[model samples]
Target: MELLPRRPDRLFPVLLRWMAIGMLSLLAHRLVFLFMYVFQAVRLEPELQDGAVASVLKALFVGLRFDLATLTIWIGPFALLLSLTAALYALPAARLRYRLLNSLFFHAQWIWLLWLHLVSVASTYNFSVNGKHLGWEFAAYFRDLPVLLAGSFVKDPVPTTMLALFIPVWVGAGFFVDRRLSVHAGAADGHPNPGRKALLTALLSPLVVLIAAVVLFRGGLQQNPLRPGDAMSESSPFLNNLKITGTYLIVHDLSDRGDFKTFYPPEENTAFVQRMLNDGRPFVDPQYPLLRRMEARRRMPGRFATIAGPGLPGRPDRQPNFVVLLMESWSAKFLESHGYSAEVAPNFNRLAHQGVLFENFYASGGRSANGLFSILTGIPDRAGRTILRSSRIFNRFGSLPLLLKKKGYQTLFVHGGDLHFDNLDTGLPHLGFDHLAGMKEMEDSGLYSRRWTMGFHDEDMYDMLLRKTDELYAGAPERPFFAMAFTSNNHHPFGLPDPSFAIFPESDPEAAFKNSYHYSDYALGKLIDIIRTKPYFQNTIILIVADHSHHANLDYLQDREIPLLVYAPSFFQPERRTDIAGQLDLLPTLLSLSGGDSPYAAMGRDLTVPAERPFAFFAGGSNTDIIGMMRDGFIYYHYLRSSQSILLKGTHPVDMRDMQAEQPQLAVELDAMTKHYYQFARSLEKENRIWPESISE
Candidate 1:
């Protein structure tokens, strides 16, 4: 009996150990994902109650599947290496080398695990503030790492410290686990017929593991691979978002750039988009579908009527001086006028009473650059990389600033941050501005504060605006000016130079944000006071609007809703309009108000005139390829990848229930319209046809 004892199979133990290590790594990923889920659930406690619990649990299960897929894909190469090492272990001469390579591979796997953990942690904060996971857009922040890190540490030290400490602990834990695994692996016995058994095991084991990995990586035996859209739950966007892991998003984003796959013919897309934007008018050109001749809708009767401009024909009124204040992260939800209990925007509220406020106005996208692009070009943000950051930025457009410049107006663009930060320094000038000013200019004036990481405080930016306007006015008082001032203090890290503006206690969750909002409002009031004392105040038309809403716990539609105010007591009547409008409407609306009959191409209509049926189009930011349309008191969301659509009723409290089931036809129609809108814009930009070829660069 003692002579009949058989030796252990060497291949089986190696394969088992690999599987065990893989499972442990997967468990680690699951733990981090659960932590994020708990964080989100706690933050959105009020919203996720009752039946939402089951939906949340279902989403967690879906998330586990995605985590499995992500892990399998990531460890596929390591699995191959393990199989190779196992085959070599059959030879006594290669045994030592196999052990060394296996150990190295194990450590490499730990490094990858650490990376996944860090990205998941970062995504938690991103979701908390931006209502999204980490995607390719986050890569842009790496360019300004110093400022980003400084701001994070200054604003939220506790989380920053925790993240810093996580690295060493993770590494130490990896070492401990490796030591235990090493001991166990060493205690295993070798096979009787080493060479033949190891070779056979290597061949068969790799084939089995490869098939299993491929199945898991694809998320099942389904015809198609898993997609972010597959995780979407019609009942709860929060649950839908929860089902998507950061690793999946980052990898998906890198692999797919949301390129125009052309769902419909170019002609079909053009016709639909033209019909939507034509406003019952005829198209000017066969080649240019969006181009139309805009006629002035208003006549000015004032002292400035004596001044002449090309757009103002016989009436002979000077084009109104334009001062657009592109406020940063100014959510309508933070304003008293918008039913917010807080008096965080008293100054804006006061101005709203003296201006034509568009209550149903929404942003084109969820970023500053998106707002700027839409406001200037009258086009909604297209899917994929932002136009400002893409090579297509050089494409000529019928931008309002450029059109105004052609009408003998002096154009200037000023920002509170580094103009170079978002390529604004290069892109703004290329868009149309004759002059550009930013942090460098402010610093030269000695008003810049080093304490502010992004830029100087909002008050300092306001002062710079005043100074810049004065210079423009003094240089050519006869010429109307088109000046844009982009603010920065209301953004993340929410820093304030003056502590007096702190309205909430430090114990409050959004204390820093509330304080910054109050400070920006204070600056707005001061700027208005100074403007009222100037002579140009009588002729200047000032617009106060947000780049986008502050990303908070809300439905998708509500997140895009922002405040739009047109202030000029002498020109526009003080009225509150309930018509749906967006940042895209800014250019055409402003052109019509100023008595300009410029030939332009735009996707938006003049909001000054009432539309029998008005709608707004929005792109789900860089994180997702979702196109949305708000029409007929309902919002339609079309998820491109999974061909999924959601229709929601109402705005304030959007009914999260899927109305698409009851109204399938309407959903299909709206989905087609939204798709056409996005594809049309994308095609035009790519073809460099947004503007007529006659317009020279």
Candidate 2:
């Protein structure tokens, strides 16, 4: 008798075979990725050759985790669909027609897998060019696809051609492995009966596999997910980069792509942030002529010695509490402290007299984000971009808050405006701020105002600040707290907490801006008054500084000079410093006063220490293309948009002469230094060396 043909119930095994085949293909791609990375590392960072085999093994091991994450993301949905289809086909009433459907899906999966592997390889070439993996920044090229397509050949013809050639070869290799392992629906070993039990097993298996896939996708259940930063080893950046999977690097940075343009040589940029180097180490990068000169001058005898001794009665036995009041638009133009009239900021003038005042301090850039980045990270703002908000380097910088936290300080960042503004909400946390309170929290406490679009009025912020301070001190009285409070009332529209609070209210808008400045100062005075009454006042250090200056145009200063006051009655003596400083100097100065030797990096110097060549750098305007450098009783401005340099005679700035003709060397030096600073900053960002790699541990 002819036996009944056994039902083809091997769909589950075929699905399993497909999964195993896909994994093998993915593994092959990963090995190629590792090879490309190692090749690049040896070229860029020659030092990586030492223990090359060992480092590669370590990177490969680390890369496996990233690869698993990537594979799960790429294959998950398709796996689920295939598994479900197999289960459905294995039912008691299953049909042979299902084989056609399975074949269609199998082909689709093959095509998708091929595309993903090719794209992964292509991303490495891009990374090789810019030392960056694909991300939202890379996706941005799609908007200008024609330009990217056309320029790919013009800008990098050889690499583009090689990439084009390599893709097909890579995909072919994947296809070969896939074909060897794949088990299609045809000619499967027939089984007797695939009843409900067998069908249920096939269906439920996908869910079980899916759960495992999810665990792999997240790279284990850690508080922080595996990021590109985790790839960094103790080895060089290139070696660290070797461990970075293209997918992980790209996915992490896919959120926001702000205005970011890199305009610096990688080596020069790397050497520019010399803060990680020991003090005795020489920073002699010829590419950075300005830094070289500054380094040489600093090496002079008595140059780094204290310029002004501590004026306090006694130094603190422990680290003092730091209260940084980053006032909004607190321009020196409205303060008598910076030679402006006392009418607009009498309270500020009084505080200046009672504190250490930086007389010629300039803002790093026009925006608050620039000022915040400079003050916190001690890095100058990139010329044309918000470096803090736009770069992956945000997490890398040896931040003030992070260092302070190491020194047992509770780091807190309070802003009257929404912290989400300019991506500050996400950025500040990465910079190591432990607690962030913004407009919503401020409004919940009834400290917010609807009069201004910015957020809370100055007085309201101060009131809320006092309450927060009390709560913090009560929670941890012994632990020194480093609180940075950002005010927003003095921003655009220039509305005060109350009209009566304005000391210099005028009918004119500029005059009203001055009045708002006065109101901000008054609010500061209230906070100070409340602090003095509290027991924490004696050991507290209050640093009141501007996020950036208003366009008062009172002087011909090439940059916008803002008032910087360090009121540490227990540590600093009341003295006005004429040394040119900027927001970059703030963190270094504070660290010096705290007497903390935390291994940190900063672009600015400690003003309390003497330096031979003191200069203030600033770049502002619509595109932030106007770069300016102030030094040696003269100011130079380089307008990138116009490619013109202007040299002014004195502080008043009226006498403008052709920089090339009048002070050719000075103008050239300023222009080169500005470019060098920005380039170095950008390079640091690209290398992911903004913060020391060992910070997390």
Candidate 3:
């Protein structure tokens, strides 16, 4: 009677209904995540902290006032869409269990979206400042692969874990809606119903298509993403244009490390693709040999000077433990007139008082990596990439440190971020360093930012640095050592550390710069104190320089323009140097200062004494390079592409084209210098050798 109340039939339909609902919800969830990826392409990295969410919720208590209306402008549309989607997802389902399954599906989508946001932040925020393509620098990360695969193996693990976590959340949300909102809305149909059969058939083909699309798209974007040679070939006709534009972009991106006003359209983007492609062309000609190198001499003066070698580093009678501190984002203009204000480094000011301060020292490049390359190798970044990226250029880079090590100086490098991020770990050892230290190398990894949104707070870096100083210099036969310290406090995301947290700024950019400088100074003071305790206090040489200009604050000026100050406890204190010098001169100058033999093919003359040449710094591109040269109490700004030159007198701009054109011989001489610089760089890259014995001034 009553059809025997067939329980098996009822149970079968109920199960089918749940299975169908789960599949549809999963599909919808994945669709939302795809749009999130599109947002990242334009550099909108959304922050997702539980704390930030809490702050927004608390603002609700502030009342529905007109003041809150302004907050809606930016996120209003997206917020509305998300709300509508959430409401749709919360609709009453046919079965209780099915609703719960659907909720878990939606939550998994959120986990996927979060992973994309993290990557968008990581790549853009981290600053290396080399005028080269960042995409090809990594051993991992193909443009075509799933973003998670583009990163390391570990990068995808957390997202996978989060997806697992979301299943429970999704199931619970579905159950809550079903029991509370849809209990009465359900029909006589159970979990296993005809509805489920239809749902499965509807999605099966599309689902297969979706997966195929992901694979096909990735394949189209990058045929093979991980291989280096893949970057050498242009991906499209558009990419050829991207290469030519990159040369212009390098001046804007790598040098000043600032967004230029797109002097030409694809300024930064073009430069972002130059993976050792010297402005759409390779730096080294394929057939070039080490013996017949330095051929890029006729192109430009900057290239010429860059190719010429600084012959034989002078012998170090007693090469003291040298510590070259490359302070990040520093300005040289502050030291020009009244000296850096309390707004900057007081200790550095004092150090300048005790040391030989290059009043007119200029940085060859506008980036940290670029300036470092110029300083260490005494060659410009004409290789179209960073020295770290092209380790195969020579068996050893410059050999300045390796030679010093032979002279008995232990060498070490210290940086704020992970050294491997830019391949510093792989490349620096070849640069002749005995050791490398970065945030990862430190034992006390501070709770700076797990994400490092702004990167490791400079104060944390300074603290970590001090703790590791002894370990870095441990048991080194008591000979002089060369320690390179890179400071990052003044860098990005611009958040300051608390006084309780570390000795950082009280809260303004001016204060932040001062805080960072102070922290670095204190660390220097501590290192100096250690030197005082050791026997090398009087014999040690400390060179304080900036890797690049403080691009964040243009008003601070002197960005590519920098100061070079050398401090020795009692060795030599010339006090002030009016000689013109660029970062390319650093190696030769230091070698001369330490009395070491000059290396082969260093274009820069020694600046430890007066430099006979004008202060020249080149911004590269086929056109539109901002070349600033100094001569006779005047700074000349020349547009290399357009052949425009200006000599600003005192605080006023003056047309110096005719005046500069007067120096035909000087122009010819500078052209030769630029040629030499390129020749040397090409030699290293093509021949994989450096000739120190056959070098000449």
Candidate 4:
């Protein structure tokens, strides 16, 4: 007897048809991703542009795999149901009922395809605006949908119009495609196979589809499932982003939210962190692991020590006033002092020669919020969450502003943008800011004529800083002040009020960015000029640093590297320090320089004091979960999710080659050290132990 029926089964043709639709849907996703890649490539750096063709091909190949995985997830259940319905069609009695059900499933696939295309278009627009695919920010954007749409129309009308038109047009095309592909499922043959054979085929077909679906959903038979980081083969961030589908990013980021798991015991993590921070000194209290009483080491005798200034209060020593300029997107790579060919920050370069400049300084994380959280609180930015936006913002801390308040210094936070953005208005005050100012305050002043998309121009913000400083001194001239002004003009979309500052031609890809940098530098020069004329200028110390680097096609180390200048010519001598430091060190270093001996909790050490084992810990990568440590002429990167680590040698032009295999022992040591810091940070934040209100408790 024949092993199977001579005629083809009805289920076979229906299953093949469904497979064809699934493949086409996947292909459509690939094409949309290709469009995003090309759109982003328009702004690629010269080096990245040189290898664009090869990178695009590689990214597309990787993107295709992710697309398959995403599509399988989206259509797996429907496909299984269709398979069972088709198998049932092979039965003579149930043919009519199964055909209707099969048709319904096919239409459902068509609707899902339409929705996928719409999401793809929306993600393309999102990439253009934010430089990445849709992620957790989708929820924030959705909540602000009305404002976002209004801004999109006003600021980016071209892409907005195209995306708006795409919806209806794609929906019409979907309808047309569905109608054209409405062919009926194959009818059952009069000569049916034996009932046993039909039932066996029906059972076996769904099982086969289930197995295939499982394999595709996992992307292969690998020991581990595919991840967004797996697509990170290229050094260019844009290329890595292109290689992963939006569906994967959204799901990955959403799932990773609020999941701060502790890998080690609290005691183990606390002990490691305490040892690293104590510098061979004893902890002030056993109840608080990170708390320690630090000595006030004077770097150099200033005029206030001998002159008995107004803020001296019968004591010869008076605290120095602080002016911290948290510059926006001021990447070290764009400064002439940092080896850039262009003089994007001439004022910064001129001032760097008058004070101590940290040549190897890096930001604690990528975002402005990360820099603020790290620099103010002396705590490293936690992976997978921005502390400012999280529930931990309510936690007490030994923040710079709070410590300064204890020293009889007036603390203020000013920004050129809305203080409400990033929850700064509430978080800063909760962290002990005596006063807060933003765009509304500047606008209320009626200071200028022009404004940019973000808010006031850099010059306007600098002017406001001057005014705010004067007000603080007028109210309490005897009290030293700590005022932080965060700039916004150098941010994305690179808006500038004047075009004369453009360093390159409009045709140049980075022309807008160069112009914004130039204008912001000019504003800095203006601020310094006004400050120099003030009587208290000699007693004030200015700290200039970037919130984070601009988003460029750069490797991990290059992206976080930023300039840190402590400018007080009358106090500290001019010197360039090559020591490794990060944003976390700012609070302790500033507090040390301010000459305060109070007990405080800080994860970072004072940069003014030489470190026995110098290292800078940072949170980075596309998802911000990668922990990196730079020490002993080597950089170690550990991906927390995958437990993948790499060791690279050198700093300038960090050699991307993995040295882990050759230096296995060093890698293991550095990896353990890095994880200790990560775990301790999470533990401290979770337990509210960074700085308790009362150490005795």
**What lDDT does the true structure give each of the candidates?**
0.71, 0.64, 0.45, 0.73
Candidates in order, TM-scores: namely 0.64, 0.62, 0.51, 0.63
Kindly indicate the candidate among 2 and 3 with the higher lDDT: 2
Cα deviation of 622 in candidate 4 (Å)?
A: 4.4
Counted clashes in each candidate structure: 0, 5, 60, 0
lDDT of 4 by residue, 195-247 (tens): 56556666677788788877876679875466554564344657766777666
Query: Candidate 2 on 1-697: residue-level lDDT in tens?
Result: 1011112234445545545555565556456545556675777676776787887788767867777777665666666666566666566455454445555665576577655654555555555565655555456554554454455456546655555455355445544654433344335423435566556666676676678677877678754445554554343655555555555565555532222334456555455435322244354434332132111111112222232232212333256788999988777766775456777777888888888887888888888888998899887775564654443543467778887787677888887787656666667877878788888888786645554777777677677777777888899887778889999878878886666866553665577777777777778887788888888888788988888876555455523777888786766567878887888877766666555444556777766566677877776633477666677766777766566667776465356565467778887776666666655655455545555446322
Q: Locate the minimum summed-lDDT window of 10 residues in model 4.
A: 303-312
Give the least accurate 10-residue stretch of model 2, judged by summed lDDT: 293-302
lDDT by residue (456-488, candidate 3, tens digit) is 655555555545456645554355677777877
Per-residue accuracy of model 1 over 126-199 as CA lDDT, tens digit each: 55454556655355444644454455456556655566456546555545654434533343334324556556
How big is the positional error of residue 363 in model 1, measured in Å on the Cα after superposition?
0.8
Q: What is the lDDT of residue 122 in candidate 1?
A: 62
Answer with 1 or 3, whichever has the higher lDDT: 1
Candidate number with greatest lDDT: 4
Off by over 4 Å in 1: 1-259, 300-317
